[model samples]
Target: MKELEERIRREGAILSETVLKVDSFLNHQVDTELALATGREFARVFEGEKITKVLTIEASGIQFAMAAGIALGVPFVYAKKKKAVTQSDKVYVAPVHSFTRGETYQVSVDQRYLNAGDRVLIVDDFLATGAALVGLVDIVEESGAELVGVGCIIEKSFQEGRGLLEAKGVRIHSLARIAAMKPGEVQFIEESGNRQLIEERA
Candidate 1:
């Protein structure tokens, strides 16, 4: 987690008070070593949960979920943002609003990949609005699977995502939590109580 915090400080771009762009490393051009390390960290955090499968939304969440799956020795499933011809009719569906893209879309997962007997851990790239993640949780509930918890790579702590998920009694673990951010500056919620400065503007 320390390494992750360091990366954010060094490479993350503070676009605004609300948008912190980490595409250069975390999402777009990913660092394989960091991704695996994040998976191992999540595995360590949720060690005794007996997680059977890892779930995530497609695209950005896929890599982290796959990493988590490998660490946990389980398969991973991703919900498609749009229903495709290859998808079956018997799928769990939920609505999600993407604040970034300014649109709402239906996300779905095939029923065969999930069921009442499995325990699920949801993983994602960012935990900001909680929209996509909330949709995944709804699908998991509809499938009758046990919700283990959620693991996130980066979390905008100033946002309502964590609060919303917590209201549903979901446990969340985020490697890097941003307390606040603005152009050329960023602040992190220090889980270790050290309160380290991530970045500061000149």
Candidate 2:
């Protein structure tokens, strides 16, 4: 996690509208070492939880989610960005607005992937407006799956994502939390709790 935080500080690009572009190492080009380390960190953080499956939305979430699933020894399921033609009738769907693209779209997963008794951990590369995260949570609820927690690599703390999830009684573990980002500069929040742990490593 320390390494991740450092990477964000050193290499992360802050695009317009609160978007943190980590395409060099994440979000676009794959960094297997860092991705695997992130997965192991997530597994370590949520070790005691009875996680049956690792759930994540498709696109950016797939790499980190798959890495975490591998480390947790569980199957990883990705919700499609849109309803696929082969999607089953028994599926959970949610309409999510993309803050980055300025568009609304649907994401879904097969009902068979999640069930009433299963424990799920949602993983993703970043947390911005929390719209996608909310949609993922909705899918979990629709399938009657227990959402144990959410794990994210980089979270923009200035956004409402963390607050939204916390209001829903969901615990979020973000490796790096950017309090603010300006041109050529990024600030990480220094809260006394987990934030301190992240800062200590920095």
Candidate 3:
């Protein structure tokens, strides 16, 4: 995950104490090679879990989830933010609040895609609010699937997201964990259990 940390340091925009904009590379315009590498990281981290399916919320989570499914040789499913006519009538639904969008969505997954027999790994782009992932976890519990763990591309370690997931006993692994951030300065938790500060130059 050093490469990912490096990318964030070099390309990510620190807008505020609570906002980091990675759209230039991570989201709006993705780096395919990096995305695949993240999948490999998730696969390697959860290699022994025997995952049967990958789940994610729609939009930002789709690519990473698909990459993970490909690495694990399984099909990926994404919960629709808006139920479509093609969406399943019988589904597991949960309320999700998007802090970035200032809105709430009732996300859902088709009953046919998940059940008691499947072991699931949930992947997503960021872990800040824990809202969407918590909703997905609720759906997984509703389906009776075994949740192996959650894999995140980046995590704001200072936030309540990690705490919320831990309270629910959900295991989480994030590639780049930000200990703190602000305009022109960011700190990341190193693998050695220490924080490394990076200062942006003008």
Candidate 4:
């Protein structure tokens, strides 16, 4: 965790007053060492929960989710951004609005990958407006799977993402939580419990 905190402080770029961009190592560019550590940390947190599968959205969430699945020795399932030819017809879908891309999209997964008796752990790279996670959670619930928890690499604490998930009684675990981000500076929130802060700005 210390290494992750240090990496964010060093390589992460504060894009304005809110967004902390880690594209150089996280969101875009891949950093395997850190990614593995992040996954391991997530596994450590939810180790004894009897997680049968890890659920995540496509693109960014896949990397960490895969790593976590490897560490936990569980299969990981990712919801596709769009329907593909290879996708199974029997699926569960959820619509999500992405604030960053200014678009709304649906993420879907094969119903066979998840079921009513499954215990799922949702993992993602970032938690901004909570839209992506919300959609993923919806899909999991549709399959009647028990959502054990949510694991995020970088959480924008100011966005009300955690509050939204907590209201549903889901436990949230983030390796790095940005408490505040200002022009040329970013602060990581170290405390837990319900507290609202600014997540991003133009």
Candidate 5:
């Protein structure tokens, strides 16, 4: 997690008070080593949960979910943002509003990949709006699968995502939590027991 925090500080671009772009290493051009390390951390944190599958929304969340699946020795499933022609009719669907894209879309997962007996661990790139994640949670519940927890690479703590998920009784673990950010500065709410703060400015 320290490495991740360092990367964010060094390479992350603070576009605004509400937007921090980490495309250089986290999402677009991914650092595979860092991603795997994050997966291992999630696996360690949720060691006893007996997770049977890793679930995420397609596109950005796929890599992290796949890494988690590899670490946990389980298969991963991604909810498609749009239904495909080949996809079956018997799928669990949930509506998600993307604040960034300014649109609402239906995310879904095939019923054949999930069911009542499985335990699911959700993973994602960013935990900001919680809309996409909440949709995944809904689908998991609809399938009657046990929700183990959620693991995120980066989280904007100032946002309502964490609060929304917590209100639903969901456990979340994020490697880097941004307490606040601005055009050229960022502050991280330390996760370590000491509660030490880490601040960076461009």
Candidate 6:
């Protein structure tokens, strides 16, 4: 994770107090090696849990979820941003507002992919607004899958996303937790706090 923090400090662009762009390496054009490392970290953190599947939202989160699935040796599933013509009618849906995109969309997952017997680990690229993560959590609840926890590549710790998920009893782990950020500076939360984060696992 220190490596991730270093990359962010060097390459991340902070447009404002609320916007941080990392598409250069983390998202749009990904660093394959680092992405795979993130997967291994999540697997190690959540080890011993009988994780049956890894879940994520479509587009950005796919790679990380796939990576985690590989590390955990389980299959992965992703919720489509919009329902496809071929998608099943019997699917769980939730409304998610993309703060960056400034719009909302209904994300859906096929009912057959998730069920009571599954233990799910929801993965994502960032945890800022928590809207998307919340939607995915709702779908997981609707499907009756036990949500082991959420794994995010990066997190804006100053945001409400963490509080919102914590209120719902969701455990979260983020590789780089930014306590604050501005146009030229980024502040990360101390690693000393992660022991509590890992211990609070559900």
Q: What tens digits encode model 5's per-residue C-alpha lDDT throughout 86-118?
A: 999999999999998999999999999999999
Model 6 segments more than 4 A misplaced: 194-202
lDDT of each: 0.91, 0.86, 0.91, 0.86, 0.90, 0.92
The local distance difference test score of model 2 is 0.86
Candidate number that wins on lDDT, 1 or 2 = 1
Clashing pairs in 6: none
**How many backbone overlaps does candidate 2 show?**
0
TM-score of 2: 0.92
| lDDT string, candidate 2, 40-96, tens digits | 999999999989999999888999999999999999999998777888977788999
In angstroms, how far off is 156's CA in candidate 4?
Answer: 0.7
Write down the TM-score for model 5.
Answer: 0.94
Tens digit per residue, CA lDDT, model 6, 17-85: 979999988889999989999999999999999999999998999999999999999999999997788
What residue pairs are clashing in model 1?
none
- State the local distance difference test value for candidate 3: 0.91
Task: Output the TM-score of candidate 6.
Answer: 0.94
For lDDT, candidate 1 versus 4, the one ahead is: 1
Model 3 regions more than 4 Å off: 195-202
Q: Listing every candidate in turn, what is its Cα RMSD in Å to the true structure after a full C-alpha superposition?
A: 3.7, 3.7, 3.9, 2.7, 3.3, 3.7
Query: What does candidate 3 score on TM?
Result: 0.94
Cα displacement (Å) at residue 112, model 6:
0.2
